[model samples]
Structure formats: structure tokens, C-alpha cells
Target: MGDVTTIRRDVLTLPVADVGPDNPLPPLCPPDEIHRPDERDGEGLPRDMARQIGYGRLRSLLPERLRDGYGRSRAPRAVDTLVIENDRLRATVLPGYGGRVVSLVHKPGDRELLYRNPVFQPADFALNGAWFSGGIEWNTGATGHSTLACAPVHAARVTAPDGGDMLRLWEWERLRDLPFQVDLWLPDGSDFLYAGVRVRNPHERAVPLYWWSNTAVPEDRRVLAPADEAWHFGPERRLRRVPVPVHGGTDRTYPRRSEYPADHFYELPDGRRRWMAAVDADGRGLVQTSTDVLRGRKLFVWGTGSGGRRWQQWLTEPGTEGYCEIQAGLARTQLEHVRLEGESEVAWLEAYGPLTADAGTVHGTDWAAACSDVEERLERRLPRAGFEEAYKAWRTAADTEPGELLATGSGWGALEVLRAGHSLPGTPFDESALGDAQAPWQDLLRSGSLPEPRRAGPPGETLVAPHWRDLLETAPAHPHTEYHLGVAQWHAGDRAQAVRSWERALGLAPSQWPLLRCLAVADLEAGHRERAADRYTDAFDDLCRERRDDGEAWTAATAALGREAVAALLAVGRTAPARSVWERLRPATRRRGRFRLIEAELLLAEGDRDAARAVFDAGFEVADLREGAEAVGALWSRITDEPLPERYDFRMRPSGGGGA
Candidate 1:
């Protein structure tokens, strides 16, 4: 162990000038507009999933009339910020700005490792439209501008177990009703700092959860991770697996902007190799490692010399060079639901710092060889006691049977794999010999290794029955058995049977939204508009009831489903039912100061000019309502033959306008 005397803390501030609010109110999207949340349907995204996945829709709907521009307000200047350093490394955390790690420097070389933003500026880039770039952005709760991301958190400095300094930042996630805390511990002599995160759910009901740490490094650096294959998302939204480290005859681990921006995923198969790095050619850079809890690695960069990349630079700062994100996620990717049981808490530790290549002969541009160099350096730089013990523990955990780990409560975040309704291989036993099939089939279902349905062809009823029939015959009580049976039934084009299976699954898991959503979709596709609307509403109500304090979640759901449900009713010319949905969602929408334009449009469609004007006045900005204003104006002109209200000024028309 090294001496504890070397740990120190200092305060420095990076001067910030407020850019004004978002300027020129953005337009309102039609209530029924379909926006795909992810490459897929976002079937079961966990809480705290990254904001980029469909959460941005919430912000796009709420128009920001005026935006603050960072360029004109102030010049770059040094200001007070928080710093914690040991003998080997220095790390700075901005307490005033969402507790982001604004800087991390290697003490030996006096080199800055993190991509530090030159100006403290924010743009409407996040889901809820307020995010600053660079550094490490800790995301928690269900995506978007997490209530905690931009808000000030509770910060404190305390002594670590080894008598070193530790900085603790914590916040209560108001939206999900969870409390999350992080401790940044810089030991006296270690080259790396440990970031320990803890999230606790106080409620008795299990809730879906998500957590990710996004670290920004210079774009010139190469990234490396231990993985055999990578997932390639095609243009048509299919995932293809290719060998990692090298893909398409190129080394993908190296950072270079692409012609088109894309996100690449590498699965950390087991605990032993759950680490990634951003390094230069000489094998010198930062390495990030985490416990099995954070098993996903992502490499993302804005395409080189693209308009979007240029715009990003301009939004963050002028002369801002490009940077790539090396992200560590709690799961393989965002949006997959990970259940956090009631009153349970999950914790994990992540560490990253500088690596100095030594002893190893430099090999030709091989990522594996580079990783070996870093590993050797890590073994030498980390104290024997800490490094040896952690390595042993990780190896032991990694070596454990994957199924045994699940049984022992070790793979809590990976429960998504256990979701029922997956398809399975057909048994050799004859279909008439149902009694002989049950015992063997139940074991397969219990193993959670059933293959997912192939989307290549239309659902085949004959193919769907054999696998699930055996399980249902053998284990009728298993909800997952019913769930999988339902999915198979749906695929086979047996809608009635599929609904029956889903109903059974719901009986077993009442709050499970996927089952409800699947049923609703089936209803909608079958032209049962009223039934579909009711089912959608029920699922929406269940979601809101579970997360009552989360208005953003409510807003997201309203935009994604509630509005669609209402539109489905309207599409079928069912005005009374549509009005009911509008009324039920009015409180939350009004609280967010949105959707009044849609409400007005609905009213105008019904020829209720007086009521439409009332809602329009409540929701529209007198100066920036634009097309919504004109639509309302035209309707009132036709109905009442009156001049526009004085508040409505159409003198300076924008290039275009449209109906709400």
C-alpha cells in the first residue's frame, strides 16, 4: 500500500456565461406522428436508458421559443472548479454543472486525457433539450434530461477506507422515485480512480432501470475492448454479428470519423474481459474497467467532416475539435428492460486512468497486443494487494456458470434474457404424444436459452405450436411459458389464440406493459380501434400509476402512445372517445405546457371555435405560434367573421407555415 499523505483536493471554476433560452419557437409535431424510439420498437427499454433513444421526442414536442447562444456572451476564462488528485493522477468534477468530470490529467506527463470543453455551454441536444458536451456525463433514471443531470446534486468530500480522499455526489431521482449516489475515490498512490455507483428503489414494486457512464476522449485516439464479435445494425434495422477488433477488413477499434455517423456495439461476454480503452498508437492512454454489472461497451463518433459534426462543434464551442464517446452501460445496450425489484439496491465500481507502456515490445498495430501492453502496465502500476485481489475476484466470477450466476442473483441486470414468449426448437416427439413432451420441454424453458423468433417470414401457426405446446402442457403455471406461447401464436397469424395467451400472461404479470402493448397492437392491426384505444389507455394508465411522480415519463408516453390512441379513435371518427383521452391526459400535458395546439386542432375539427380559441390562448405563444396561430385564425375567421386578436401578429412570416 502507498502512503495516504499524497491525496489532495482543490477548487477551480470554469467561467460560464448563460446563453439565452432557445430562440424562435420550434414547431409542434402532429399528435399522431410515429417516431421510432430505437432501431427497434423499444419493446421494453429499462428506466434510465440513454436519452438519445426516443426521449428526445419529448423535447421536440415542447417548443423552446428562445434559446441562449454561448458565442456572444463571454470569453473563455479560468474559474473555480473542484479537483481531487493523488500522486499519479488528477481529476476535476464540476459540482455546479451536473457533477460532470470536466478534466482528468496524468500527473507524470502533465497530460490531459479527457476532452475538456473550452466553454461551458449547453444546447438542446438532450432528450429534454438541455445538455453540455465533453467530459463524463452520468445518466440515470429513464433517459432524456434526467432530473439530476443538469440540476445541482448533493456533493461532499470524505475519507476513503485507505485514508485517501473521496468525492461523493448523490441525488434523489424524482421521476423514478429512486436515489442514486456515486463516490469518486482517488487512492493515495493508485494510477486509477474508482467510481462506485449505487441505486436503490424504495418502492415494493419492481421497476425497470437503466444506468450508463459516457466518457469523451479525443477523436484521434483508438479504442479497444475484449470482444470476439460486434453487432452491425443494417440500414433496414437488422442486427448482424461480425468479428470484433477487425470488421469489414478494417480495425474498428481505431477511432476515425465515418462517412455516415453510426454507433457500434461490442458485447462484453464475461466478467474477465469487461474493460475498454481509448489510447494512442504507442499504447499510452486511459483504460476503463468495471465490474460485471456494467457489461456493455459502445464506440460512437460523429462522422468526419459532416454537417452534423460541424453543427455539434459550433453548438458546444468554436474551434472545438472532434471527440468520440467510449461508453459503458449497465446492459448490452440501452432500452432493454432490466428489472430492479422492490426495495432492492444494485451497486458497481468502475475505474479508469492513464496507462504508460513499459517492458512489452511494440507490436504492429494489433489491438490485442496493445491491450496486453496496457494490462502489463496496469499489473505493474496498481498495488499488488488491490490488483491481485480484484483480478482473482473477477476471474472467479467470470468462470462461474452463466446460469448459476443468474440463480445466485449475480446477473440481475441481465434478466431481460429471461423474459417469456421466446420461440424454441421443436421437439422430436410426435405432436399427438403431448404427454411425452412436457417434462423435457419445461427444462428448456427454465434454462432461458430459447431462440428468439426469426423475422424472416410470416408467422406460421404449425411452427409456433410444437415448441410452446409442450411447455404449456408441462408447465401451465409458468407465465413466461404463456408469454412465449402468445408470441409464437401471434407469429403464426392466429390473432385470437395470441390474445388468449397474452391475457393469461397478463393475469400472471399485471403490470407488464409489453404484454398489454402487444395486445393493443394486435387489436389496432385487426381494425378494433376502440378496443385498441382502451388497451393502450390501460397500459398508459398502468405506466403512469407506477411512475406517478414522473411527468416526463407521462409526457413521453403521451406522445408515443396516448396521442396515438386518441388519434386511432379520431381516425375511426369516434369523437367522444377521443375527447375522453384528451381530457384524461390534459392535466399532465398542461403541466408540461404542451399539446394545447393539438387540443385546439381537435376542437377545430369538431367546429368548436370558441373552445378551440380558449385552448389556443392557453397554450400558444402570442408572438411565435406560427402555423398553429394561422390555423386557429383561419378557423375562427370562417366561424365568427372576426378580425384576428391583437396578440396575433402575422406581419413577419417565416418561409413556411402549416396547420397544427
Candidate 2:
């Protein structure tokens, strides 16, 4: 047989002999006639009665009390049996529970099984099962009440080639004699699977309960949840970044692909539900599943990123590919009736199948196509939306109190809207109309809001804030704001103002390493070696702490800061201290191409010309790592005692010899 084939019939074919008469056949088993032991000699007198049994004694093993409890007292009994015969496999499904076959088999040859009952162990549930530990607890003293709550929870399971005998089962006892119901299914046969729950108020009196799905999957997997926005929380659990709506509307979607590794809990938009898929890159077929349709279900996706967060292992396996499962239920609560009621409605699922490797690629392409179509529809609808009226309002807003309205925070929205307007084929706001907001425009330019700040004359010259000073004043103060303001002041020949701004920033929040480094350099320029040394110490301390806290961010920040620090220290004859700091930093931080030249400088300072030459030689081996234009110019200045290169030239061509 070829590697790929599609079977036409819903039922699969299985080898009869492969199945164990004592145990249930796998879901994938194909159907065919096979020999059996003595027919009915054990219970009945008939000798031919046993040859037709497919699931063997499994059908009889299900407790009759359990079956009666699941249905009406006098309802017609339904046959729950697995049959294998004539190259076709079949299982009888009961009607009461959505007519779903709780136990299903594919072909006899297929080794996948739909359900199995494994012995329960608390330790196994604690360590291997999901929803056993650290979840919201609920207890109802035979009093039925309905309540819904939400809490962060986790669950996991491992499926290997061996241990087919082990199976997982969960049971919920009714406290208030309310109807306990659950809908479980493996919707996707690949990488991800999900279970959804819904609780109904069967009784006239209200019920309360706490519920959650402690769902777990193999470590080292990733999750994809549909999100319209995201939020960031700092170490203190304080809101770092507010929920910023994913810029593209719901219709304007992008492939939910992550460029960087992360594990985070993303909330879906209110009123709209979303599905999540867990993926293992190295797995065979994607194990996908989803929740059953219920009156109300809230979806959530939580996992870790490539970074070493506690939950990252669930989303990403260390050496091998992993798996992920989605658990859906009522939120979390503490009340007894509430917990019991919630448990009645809890949903769980398990799926084992090979995942298609190119599923993500296919899904991503489809998303892109859909988004393009949506954008086109939006574009067609724009002409009828009274664009002229909106443009007039925008222009009016831009004219009056132009500075305040176009200030830092306010202008960002307006800027985005205005840019969007420009992209449209027929926009009401003419270029000249946009230019009419010049006062606000000048305010932004004067405040250094533009990408590049305007240059000013020599030192000691009288200076004034640009025409848009009010607009600049309205902009919020961020860490970079003061730094940029200082740069503007320096260019305008107000050295004192620049220094004061930097100092003010440092006083406000001393842990800002970039500002500290800048302050240190300014001190060095002013011949304040002692002050510079103190500033350097502060910067080094903050960076070192950050490095120890998070290696990646620390490496990035250090690489950027270390280069400047090395140069400044060398200028101030503090090579020894600089060298010591460099040593403490990670090798990844120093091996950057930019640092190679710095290494040469440090060697030259130590009077090791050969070592410096070797560093330069290594740098030359990488074509792009050759000495930067500004560095060469600096060397020429040192050799010939010529005037320094122009500021604009220096800025335009920076020494790009740094590690990233």
C-alpha cells in the first residue's frame, strides 16, 4: 500500500485475530470473521453462541446500575456492543446521550481505541492527570444550586507506544439530585483536542457551584487561541500594558503564528467565542479536538512560550515534540452546590492520532485569504460611510487646541487614522488640509516627536522651545521622553537644561540603565570622574540584576549598553573596571562583531598589539564586520589631528560594530 490513502466508507476494516477477546478492540480495528473459543459453554449450554461477539465480554462488564442511572427508569434498553465482521467494524450508540457512541472502533487492524477504563490512583491523577491539583474546589451537601466561576487551572497526560492498558476516567456524584450531564469528544483527530461544558438551571430555584478543567498536555508544545487583543502583566501582577486590540479587526486576521516563544493566557472578545488548537511540530498527525455545542461556553487558551516560564513546558517539550489539550467548564467558585452543579456540566476529551505536518501552513494560508477578502469588502464599504463628514470633524479637531488635541497620546490615534485615510483610494482630507494643522505639527517637531530632531547652532546660543511647545508639553512623559528632550536641549546649545533633564529622570526612577549610562557619559564629558564612576556603578548594578533575572533580555540590553560603556571607560582611563564588568557579562554579549573592535581597543590599551591585531583579523574575516565609517574617521582624526567628522555624517553612518 502507498503511504497515503483515503477510505471511502465510514467504517474501517480490521484483522479479527489481532483483537483480544478479553479486552476491547482498538477503534481502528477493521471488521472480519475470526475464530472464537467455546461458544456458550461457560454460561449457557449452546456451543455456537460466542463466535459472533466482537468486543467480547466488555459489553457485559459495564455495570447495569450505571446504565440505569444514565437513563429513565422504564426506558427501552439499548444495546451497547462492538461488532467486527466481514471487513466492517460497528459499535451500537445509545440515543439518550446525544446518540453518541461513547465506545467506538474503526478497523480491527487500527490500534487506536476510543475509550478504556483504568484503575484510579490519587498520585497518578496528581502528577499525570489534568484538573486534579491546584484547581478551584467545590462541595455541595445534597443541596442543588447553580453557580459559575473561573480560575487558572492546568492538566496533563502522556500517551506512549506502550501501556495501552492504562485509561483515564472521571466521575461526579450528584449532591442535590440534579441532573449530572457531560459531553466529551475528540473533535480533531490531530495535534489538538478540546472539551466544552454548559450548565442549565433545571430547577426553579437557583443553584451555585465552582468548576474548572485542569487540562494538561505533554510538555514542549505550543497553543493557538483566537485573540482580538492581548495584555501584559509585570512581575508585581500589575497591569503593564493595557488590553490593546489587535490592530486588525476581527475580519482582518493574520495567521495566529508566533514569531517569538511565549506562554500566556489570552482572553477572547466579549460575546464572541473562540476555539484553540495545540500543536506538536514533530508529531505525526495533529491531534485536534473541540468542545460540544452547549448553551453557553467560554473559551480560554493558556500555555508557555520558548522562554522558561513555569508553564512553558506544557506548550513546548524540551527535546521531543509535545501535545496540548483544551479543558472547558464553568469558571471557579468555592460554594458546595455551585461546585457540584459545575461538575455536572464539566466537559473533558482525549484524542490520539497522527497530525498532518502542513496543517498550520494550510490554516495560515486560508486565514490570509480570508483576511484579504475582508479587507476588500471593507474597502468597498468605505465610500458609503460619509468619509467627508468624518474628515471635517478630524480637521476641526486638528485646528482648535491643536497642541493639546495632537499631544503625545492623543496624536497616536489620529496619526494612525490619518495614515489609514492616506491608504484609501479616495480620501476627503487633502494633503493641504492635513498641512493646515501646522501649529500642532510644529509642536510635535519641536518636542522631538519626529524620527530625527532638528539641529541647532553652537553652544551658549539663546534657545527657545519650537512653536509646538504646547503640543510637546501635552505629550506624556515616558522614560525615553526625557532622554529625547535632553538630546533636543543639547542640540539647541542648552547644556545645563539637558543635564538637568537627565538628572530629573534618574531621580524619578533610578533603575533605568540607559539613562544612567547617559548621565555617566555626560559627567565624564564635564570632567567629573567621581560622579561618572558612581553613575557607571548604578548602571552596571541594574544591568547585572536584569541579566541574572532574564538571560535573553539581559543579553540584548547589555550588548547595546556594554559597547558604549567600554568606549566611555576607555576614554576616561577606567579600562580595568570596564574589563571586569565585561568579564561578568555572558560570552554571547561580548562575541558580537561590534565588540571585536572594542576588544582590539582594550588589547591596545594593555599594549598587546599582537592580540589587538588578531582581534582585527578575526573581525575582517566577516565582511560586514569591517571597521565602520565613523570608526575609521575617528582613527584618522587620532592619527592626523584633523577636525572631527560632522555631526550629521556621524549620525548618518553609525559604527554598526556591535553584538545584537
Candidate 3:
């Protein structure tokens, strides 16, 4: 309530005080304001402040003692560790903790500076060099430590102005142990960090506490979250809360660089959970957080706006200094019994750091983890007996239908059986076996007739029925089946037959995704560049509409087909068309190393070596996809007509080549 500027500076020095009789006092300084001195020289200004003050300020604050300390402790022992498991994404967790993560490093390599551990000096609490009166308190009580007491869990000493070191502390508590279990990973290679913290009340007495993860963002960082309503509590308790829908859109937080003073809280309606992001202005990097549980949680974002007043305004600014505080339960006592009990027993918290600047790079990792999480949750909610029974029924139906089709000697009868199999409601097609089905279908297309019945059909029908008659009588002759049949022919070396089958498939299901995809591949293999480009374009368009809801198959298909489409478009001298396709697909495709090689090809065609090299650099980061990268390198060598690195190899290699 004193001068707002002074309050922002003094907030961290003050002892934990109760905001109410029951709740622990909210910390004074915002969580992000805590400093780390070892990384920086003097007063450990939060990352945002350091940026505003300029690196020159950082250089001037270079404390001699800290410099000497860093020189000696550059390879300090692992203070904390988190090991990502096979089930969890290795990429997300490795980059998230920055340098503090000693056990796991991302596949390509880690980002510099962002990932290093920070050091702290006590005087960092004050804007000036004077030592502050605060110290981190590690406390636990029989009633469980108050959420407010959870602050000061992590602290750092960073360089300050005037050649001194300042202490910066992060106030958030670790819900899980360091090196805890990672439950899942997105196909894109990002990880999901999950930890459960238990809060216990040994005295058997009810306790009231307000809990919020003091998630801090650098000063110039942006914090975005899903919201149904937002409220501001400041200016002598003048509270203003408004209703809104929960969604992603334009900047809703402080949008301008100047409006800094603001403190606000948002309430999510029941059954809603939100994903929040802390991003820099240019969108180059971001730190994202979310609560996995669907129970409604409160969001609190407070920070000094561009106006230089910390926690003042309610409006959002696109680029500004601020941080987001996320709260769950209004007060410790108010949290639902389940949440309290969960917290008492074990509370789960996860954090994924900034994915690379290219959105596509992170998409796979994000989606994989997301899908796994949803699947697990769904399974947990389903009745075990009913679920098991349903699963078994679907599998049996799929298997039996295939068997029945082979037993029908007449080709039309077999087609009818297969169609019925495909149409069975709720059949869980073994997607993993899809590749297996390709060979038989291809062989049939090549032979143009069944050479022998694997199993004899009903006694009256001949196995070699008229093709046209069979097509007319078969179950709708859907495009998907025809496409697979084409793939079978292609694999059998009957290119002409393969093309015909694919064309037939397209005729039945003009917009069927799988059919269109096969057509595109057929066109490519046949050296029909323009046709391939057109097919690829159409298939990609269809995929875009369904990407969000579909599972891994859709994701992988979309990315793979989209990349090929881009390459085909480029190959046909449709540079402009290629560019458009590239633009649309780049965000999702560029993350994997193979896409980079394709991108490099497109760039090289444009005579932009610089851009092509940049793409290559990105590809090299991926450990598994290096074959594509090497192929591209070989292409580059061909362009120069000179053998370069030993890694270059031109012949196409199998896909899915990279490893962590």
C-alpha cells in the first residue's frame, strides 16, 4: 500500500505474513523476480530486467568473487536431477530445466544460456546492493507446510550492476522429486513431467491455505492462458471480475511495453483446465505450464506493466514486462476434499520449457505426450470389465471378417466380405497391422485374379469372377480398400496395375484421405510430377481439417504426406505453389530432421544456400533423422560436385532413422 514501486522491491525481503487468519501470506516479490547471481555478475535482476538494463549493465556488475566462483564451479556436482524414461519424452524435460538437468540432454543438443544453473546472492532482494533481511526457509509441519511457506524452494546468485552478485530466488515448490518419473512423450519428442506431492495433516484438524505456483516469467515475457473470466484486485481492494470464454486468441494479457503495473486473477468454470505460456515478444521461445486434472483451477497473472508500476492495470499489452501466477483453490481450506487429499497424499505438477522457435519441431513431441495422457485418462475412467469385453469383441470382429473374405472363392463375394468387415461399427482395426495387409492386396492386383483360393469359398462360386462384375456387386468398393490394393501392386512391381488400382480407389472415394494419399504416392513413383503435386495438395488440405482430433496415425500421415507434397511441388517447378504448401506445413513438419532435408532442397532450388544451410543445421540436431540429413548433405556435395564430409550419403535410406 506504500509507493507501488517500493512495494515491488521490498516484497521479497519481508517475512511470510498471513493475508488472512487462515491463509499464509502471499510473497511480496513476484516469483520471476527472484535472482541468480552465479550466472550473472551483480544484482541478479530477473531475466526481463536484465534485458531492459542492457548486457552492459550485466557486464559492469561482474562480481570478481562470483567470476572466480563460476570459473571453479563451472562443472559443479549435480544438485538436482530428473531422468526422462522411455515412456516420457526425452526432449521436453531435457530442455525445460535448461542446464540444471545433468542426466538427460536433448537429442540434437541443448539450447545455450537458457539451460544453465543460476547462482544467488542475498542482496538481490533490494534493487540496490545492500544486503536484504530475507533468507530461504525450508519448513514442514504436522499439518503440512503452508503453501506460502512453499516459496523459496529454489534460489540463485547472479551478476548484478557495479561488480557485485545478487540473490534471486524462485518461490515455487517442487511437487515431485528431482529425477521423478516421466509418464509420456509427444511424438514430436517433447516430454511430459509428472510429479505428485502429498500434503498431510497429522493432527486430524482441518487446515486452510491458499495455493498458487509462483510461476515467473522474464520481464519482457508474455503470459497467456485459457480464461472464462478475469478479475483484478488492487488499488485498495477495488475488485473487477468479468466473464469471458475460454480459448486462444490475440493477446489478452498486458499487450503493450509500457503498461506494467497490474495484479489480476482469473476464475475458470468447473470442468475446465487451461494451458498457459510465458513467451518473449518475438515468440522465439516460451515456457508453458498446465494442470492435467480437469477440475477447475484459478489463474492469477500479476506483474509490473510498461507503466513501470508493478501490478497495476487490468488490460493486456502485447509486449511487456510481467509474470503469471497460477492458483489452485482460493485458500488451502477452500480446496475440494479431493484436491486437498491429493495434495496431502501427492500433487502432480508438470512443466515443458520452450519448444524450438520452429513450431513444427515441437508439435510431434507435444502431440505424442498429449495423446498418451488422454488415452490413459480415458482408460482409467472406463469400466474395466466393459472396456475389456468391448476391446475383445472389436478385435474378434476385425479378424473374423478378414478370414471370411478369404473363404469366399468368388472375387465379388470376397470384396463383399471385406467391405462388411470394414463397415462393422466400433471395429478396432489393428492399425499396427496395416502394413501387413498391403502385400496381399498388391499381389492380387498384380495377378489380376486369384491364382488359388487360400480357403475354398461356398461351393457354387468360381474364384476368378469377372473384375467389372465383382466391382459392381462388391460392398460400395470404397476407395481405402482400393488404395491398399494399389499399394500391394506397387510393391509387387506391377507399376501399371498399381496405378490403375489407385485410380480406381480414387474414383470410389474421391476425398478419402488414404486413397488420395496413395494416389499421390503412385503419381510420384510413376514420375508424374504435376499429378503428384495435385494429389499431394488435395490430401494435405483434407488432413488439415482433421489434424486436431485424429491420433498418431493421422499426425504421422499428415506430416509425411505433407513433406512429400512440398518436395513434389518443388520438383515440378511449381515454386510458388511449393512455397504456399511449405508455409502451411512448415510449422508442423519442420521439427523432425527429415523435413529439414526436404526444406533444404526447396531452398537450394531457390538458390538460397544460406537458408538451405540453416535448415541443414536444424536437421543435424536430431539424432535419429540424421540419414535424411546425410542424404541432403550428399545432395549439397553433388551441387558442389565435391565430396565433403564423410557423413554424406545420397541413396535414400529407410525412414524413422533417428534416435534420442
Candidate 4:
């Protein structure tokens, strides 16, 4: 190394709205829809493109619990951060929060190479329901955002390719029963920050895999990619091939051109280099280039419409610069996942830093020439062979045992190691990582019976993977055992057995709402709408009665389940009961924007159009509103015959306008 590389553990205190605690409710029921619409079969698209569009489906968020316990509440807190720097750039990483790279500063230019979010604010963006707006996010597990977005990952110091201290982050992803690692380093005198990512499937069976390295940068720039055509997926769930740069009669390469959030997945030809860059008016901004293993590159823009800008303000401090995301992924689109075979791994290396191209051509009208200019510059900056050489050199250090643990995440990884009876070598989840939360699982591994909770509290976090399910099945049957066994059975796609187990557990326990909720899903899937509503009503009732302290935790559980319960009731036209459930919610919970939306729906169901319209007139924002949900626009058309107000206009596609 030409200059001494420095690595230090530190704190980054920022104004952050806490993610609070995760919802205690296990995700037993399916979402409203699968949401992935595959219509490409007869489209005569490219063979690889056809194979990659809507390739896999994750039915529900199982194994991982729901994380809906966050809101627009803010405070300042000190976050654990790790700093790594060389002569040209400084990188600040938050190991406690998915090992996200929060900031990358080009020291020579004193310019931030990535969107350094002004504040930390969690929203309902991730698959697990808590996601912040900025930084380079390492996404794994199933799509949307990674389940690890707001969670911790194991972190330690490892040797870099240049023989300096590299920061390594690894974690056991509960959703897929796989372990992954991210190693970050900076070479002496190099302006780029290099990250090597690896996802390993230690299981003996095939697993669906998803990986996306998302980099956020200021949106007031032109994004350049190598492709002349792109796969455009918007909030409308349609994946259509469109001409790059000039889609919908305007240049889509610029983020400001779009009216709402959309994704343009560049269709780089086979055997071409994978890269994308966002350049400012001066043609100087961040560029992210990755090895071939990371096949896809994407540009996600949340445009400057009223609702889009409102969402930006909702996610962070007011008046901060908005950002657009340039992402690299394993598949061609986020709508698809590749098949990861048994006992194999997928790995890639990504480099991110500043790139300056000819400003005039980069912002010119000729799209092909614009892209070629940036490509030429990128090739000169970091040749493909140079990136491959770096990847080969990093592999030698990938298995080097990590030293000096910087932070601790969940004990789940350690528990996995105990069960597998093997070591992951470099990214070891040592026994030291195990804690009180892991006590029951450890006892289950030793004695084959999960220790039943002594308290009447809600069932704690548990595993639903096949191995854990097998252990549970072999144990003596009880309410507790049957309840968990049913969850595992459901996850394994054995609905009949799952229902039978939950039914048995419900009869014995009589008051366990979790079992009732699982049964409700079984009933729903079976087309027993009335039965499902009855079960949902009972589940909500049982949980409400079981609230011991009725504090924030209980309130959260009430709000989450109550929302679901009311929706189910209304689905079956049981508006009376739905209204009753809404009435029973705590006052503070009822005041939430989401609950207000529900209240409006309840009023509309009761033939009170005026009341429902008033809810819209008064204005409310569903902070956790789903990405493609038509709730706001659809509800507006029903309540009043008026144009969809600008503040509530979140539609990304033109199909569903302000109409009924």
C-alpha cells in the first residue's frame, strides 16, 4: 500500500426515527396479492430476458417476522459506525444496520460520492417493513428490500487484498436459510471503494435467491448505462421493453422526467461489462461497476410529483436533496430471482467512486454517443480485467479468519452453526454471539424439545426452517409445539397438515390468537370467507383481551392485527363487525394515517359517503402505504367526483388515473 490505510470503529449520531420494535405477529397469512404478473410468455422477447422476467415468487414473509412498528417519530441517537479510508476516499459503514455504507466522501474533491441521507428515517419500504432512504444498501433474502435493512449483521476486521484492514459483514438470513457476507476495502491511492459480496447456500436442496447492491445518489443528474433498450417496470406491475433515454416521449435517463417512482432495468447484452453511472451537469458523479456475476443494472427514480416529493419528505428531514437509485443485481430485474443450487455460492465484486466524462456529450441528444462516452471513461478508470484481477486477489482473503469483532448482531447465525456443526471460517458466527434470545433454540438442539415459554407473553421469535420443523415434529406434541409445527408446515407448503396442527393446538390452548390467525389463513385459502372472518374476529378478540400492560408493544400488535382483521371482515361484507373492531382500537392507534384510511373505508361500507369524503378532505397520508396500492386514488373517486388531489397522487403508471 502506498499510504497507510486506516480502519476505526466509531459512532454516527443522526436524527433518526426509530424502527421501534417489530410486530410480534408472525406472518402466517398471505399478502393481498402475489403482485408479480408474468405476461411475457408469448411476447417473443430475448431468451434470457424471457427467462428472467417474473421468474420466482415469494408467497409471504415467513420465517422472518413482520416489522411494522415504526412511524414518523424522530429523535437523535448515536449509531454504531465503522470508518475505512485510504488517501483518496473515506467510507462510513453502519454495521448495526445491514452493514450499509452510509457515506462515501471523495477526500481529494471533498464531494460525497453517494447520497448521504441527512437523517435516518425508517418507512414501510423493506420486505420486513423498515427501510431508510439513502446510502448503498446491500439487499438479500427475497425482493422489495432485504429483511436486514434495519437489522444488524455480524461485523469484524479481515485482511484486504492490499493487506490493509478490511471490514467484513455477514449474517444468517432467516427467510432463505442462507448466510451471506459483504467485505469492503479501499486500496491505497485508489479513489474507488471496492466491495466483494458472497451468498452461500449451505443447504442440501435448491433455494431461490435474490441479491441487489443499491447505490443512492442525488437525482439531479443523467444516468448512463450501456443498453439502448430497457425493461421498464413501474407501479403498474407491467414489464415492457422500451427504448432507452426517450421513453414516454421524454428522456427517462434523467430522474426529473418521471412523474412517479419507476424502475428502468438496462438490458446490457450478454458478455458486456455491467455498470451504470449518474452524472451531474458537469458530468462528474458516482459510478458503480460490478463483475459479471452481478448481471443486472437498474435505475429507480422517485420523480418530482407532489406525492413523490411528499414521500421523499416523509422518509427523511424536510428540504433535503432527493435521490435516485442505481442498482446492480444477480438477475435482470428485481421482479425475478435466480435459482441457487444446493451447497453452492454466488459471488461478485463491485467498485464505486467518482467518474467525470465529457459534459457536453453526456448531456447531449444522441443517446448512443452519450453512453459510449461514459463507457470509454469507465473502462479507462477501471478496466474489466483490473476488476477481475481484484476479485481474484480478494478471494484469497475471503477465507481469512476475521479478527477484532466490531459489533454483534442476532444470535441466529450462531444457532445455525450449532445445528449444522460446522464453521463458516472467515465470517464465523462464534458461540460468543449467542444470547438469551437463543436459549430456547439451543435447548431444542440439545434435547429435541423446544423449551416452552413460562410466561403468558406472546410467543417469541422462532425458526420455521425444515430442520427446526423436523426437530419440533419429533418432540412431544403440545399447544406450543403444535402452534410452531403448523407454521413450519405452512412454510413447507403443506396447508392441510398445517391447518390440522393449528386446529389441534387451538382446541387445547383455546385462547391462543396466533393459532387462530394461522387457522384464519387456512380458511381463507380454502375459500371459506365467512369462517375466515369469524376466525379473524376471534383472533383479534383474543389478542385484545390478552394485552397485559396495553403499552406500546400491545398497542402496536393491536394496530397491525386490527388493520388485517378489519380488512378481512370487510372482504366478506361483515362491515358491522369491521366497524366494531375499528371502534375497539386505542385512540392513539386510531389516529394514525393508516388507521384513518381504514376508518374511511369503514364509513364507506356503512353507506356514509359524506363521512368518507371528509376523511380525504381533511387529508391523511398512509406513511406505510404499499408501493402500487390504488387505495388513495380509488378511494378518492368513490367518495367524491373530483380530480385526484395532487397531494395524494402517487400513481407511477398512467393506467389508473383519478378514476373509479
Best by TM-score: 4
**Tens digit per residue, CA lDDT, model 4, 305-407:** 6667767777776789998999999988887778999989888899999999999999999988998898899889898898899999998888899888888
The residue-by-residue lDDT of candidate 1 on 531-615, one tens digit each, is 8777776766665555344443334444445556566666667677667667767474543322555576578667787887776
What TM-score, over all chains together, does every model reach? 0.54, 0.27, 0.28, 0.94
lDDT tens digits, residues 262-327, model 2?
Answer: 223334444332233334453221232222221111222222322222122211222423223333
Q: Can you tell me which runs of candidate 2 are displaced by over 4 Å?
A: 1-493, 524-534, 547-553, 617-660
Predictions in order: lDDT: 0.54, 0.31, 0.34, 0.84
User: How would the candidate models be sorted by lDDT, starting from the highest?
Assistant: 4, 1, 3, 2
- For model 3, give the RMSD to the true fold: 28.7
Candidate 4 has what TM-score?
0.94
Put down candidate 3 lDDT per residue, 559-605, tens digits, no spaces.
55566678788878887777776776645446544566667777788
Which TM-score value belongs to model 3? Answer: 0.28
CA shift at 233, candidate 4, in angstroms? 1.8
RMSD of 4: 2.3
Query: Candidate 2, residue 191: CA error in Å?
Result: 52
> How far out, in Å, is residue 288 in model 3?
4.3
